[model samples]
Target: MDSILNPSTLKNLVFDLGDVIIPIDLTAPVRNFAMLANLPEDEVWAIWKEHNFINHYETGLLDDAAFRAEVRQLLKNDVWADEVIDTAWNTVLLDLPVERIARIQELKANHRLFLLSNTSPIHIRRVNDVLTQLNLPTLEQLFERVFYSYEVRLAKPSPDIYRHVLTEAGLVAEETAFFDDNAANIQAAAELGIQAVHVQPPMTIIDYVKDL
Candidate 1:
């Protein structure tokens, strides 16, 4: 894999959603769950962090109803309302900053921008609702193609998903650059010959592409 990426050689840009484009706390849901279940935050956090349900839900193996039921089962509270489950599950989702949208718009001029995210249908609906409220363009308007884990039945760190996008877009791996917040996803893309960058916290995607 080549460590040096020349902006001039890049023709496509693949971006991750959470923590990359939109800000996500990732642990906000634990607090919400604790409050709803009247359990210690640490306890709820422990269960959530160790659960495989989230990955299953994101990969389309579990539907919304099944996922909610699993959450209730984990909390040992079957009396929880659907509203409570939704609120707790959505706590990690935050607004998409206007600056990031501006950056994407700017990048649109020269690159075929695409989105590949490991997210559930519920979260995607919430994100779209937020975008609507903000009077911003929908994800479709921002990217040429949007690939969600639930929709694609595949998630990041899986080479098949990366290959799916590349094949579908008719894009060459060496000519594409992928930006993700997870190190594992970055490694997967890199292994497939895509120039991958791990966009860490305190450093926005704009900062990563400013030099390009």
Candidate 2:
């Protein structure tokens, strides 16, 4: 993986959604589901790991109804309604930091901004709804283009997803820079010649773009 000390020549900036732009508590959904099952959070997470509907849902292999059905069985009791199931499932998403949003908006003045995220319809709906509630612009409005894994049927850490975005957006690999919280995703993008930065936190994309 490579990091450009000076990103002056990069024409496009690609951002990963969760953690990079918006902070997420990965354990939140597990905790929420565990409450429903009367199981410990770790136990519910273990069950989730076994069934692994997360990857399937994010990759578009499962719809909301199918996902809820699978999750219901994890409870070992009566099924919960769609509203309850959705609210519980969406607990992983947290509020988007206003500072990060401002950083990206400033970056947009000089660079073509794009958002590429491994996300599901359910997750994105909650995000947009929150943005609406906050009187903030939606992701679509913030980015020149947004590539969602569920909509595209491709998820990252996969080179194919990176390639798909590049080709579809007519972006040159060398002229673009990508910021992601996931190392695998950063590596994949870097392998394709995009300037890639692994955003290790307590640090963020703002750290990379704040002075630019």
| Tens digit per residue, CA lDDT, model 1, 67-110 | 99999899999998887888878889877788988888898889
lDDT of 2 by residue, 1-212 (tens): 65774566788999999999888988888888888888998888788889888899899999988888888876775558889889987898987788888788888889999999999888888998888787888999989999999889999999999999899999999889899998889989999999898998677778877766
Give the winner by TM-score.
2
Candidate 1 ranges beyond 4 A from true positions: 1-3, 49-51
Best by lDDT: 1
- Tell me each candidate's TM-score: 0.92, 0.95
Candidate 2: misplaced stretches above 4 Å? none
Residue 193 CA displacement from its true place in model 2, Å = 0.3
What is candidate 1's TM-score against the reference? Answer: 0.92
